[model samples]
Target: ARRHALRDGVAIVPAAMPSQANVVSLRMPLALYGIAGIDEIHDSVIEAQAISKGDGIKGRAHHVVDSQGASRIGRYGWKADIATLKDMVANAFANELGIT
Candidate 1:
């Protein structure tokens, strides 16, 4: 019963047996933390507005409130809905472990 296998230096694991329960098909990758701070992301948003491209797509900053009720620019989630790493971890605790 080989549940896990490794090939080409990559870990090949078994799929979720619960049928679509832990499967992510269209998930977008987020940048690693410590690479840029919240202030840097916000600054990028500001700099993006100064671009003078040919009617290019404009980027919008998504703001979310953290657990401490502090407003912050979202850096996680599909639409940047999650604000901080702490908030994302808390959400995982509630959704995955059923802990509020």
Candidate 2:
């Protein structure tokens, strides 16, 4: 994933990139476990509008093209690889907590 992001001119920063620092600071193992499915990309335009300003999650939505460049492809999975963390969490809660 890092290699592809580099090849396509995606600036691969450490997981500590400013917008992402807080999430990493959390000490919860449960939160860390699903991170890979959360903070994977950034979309400046849409990000500006999201409730979290697009900075709270850990993985990127798979089908949504990265805003940095055009030659790359998203490589994650869940909900056709485009599922949001909220969706993943909701599904997990339904199965695990029977919230529904």
**Leading candidate by TM-score:** 1
Clashes of 1: 0
lDDT of 2 by residue, 19-39 (tens): 645553434325546576444
Question: How do all models score by TM-score?
Answer: 0.48, 0.27
Clashing pairs in 2: 38-58, 38-59, 39-58, 39-59, 40-59, 40-60
List runs of model 1 lying over 4 Å from the truth: 1-55
Which tens-of-lDDT digit does each residue in 1-100 have in candidate 1?
A: 5454465465757765796567566755455567436534563665577566778765677767878898776776778787777777678779866997
Model 1 C-alpha RMSD to native: 11.1
For all candidates in order, the CA lDDT equals 0.68, 0.47
Best by lDDT: 1
The 10-residue segment with the lowest total lDDT in model 2 = 67-76
Residue 45 miss distance in model 2 (angstroms): 15
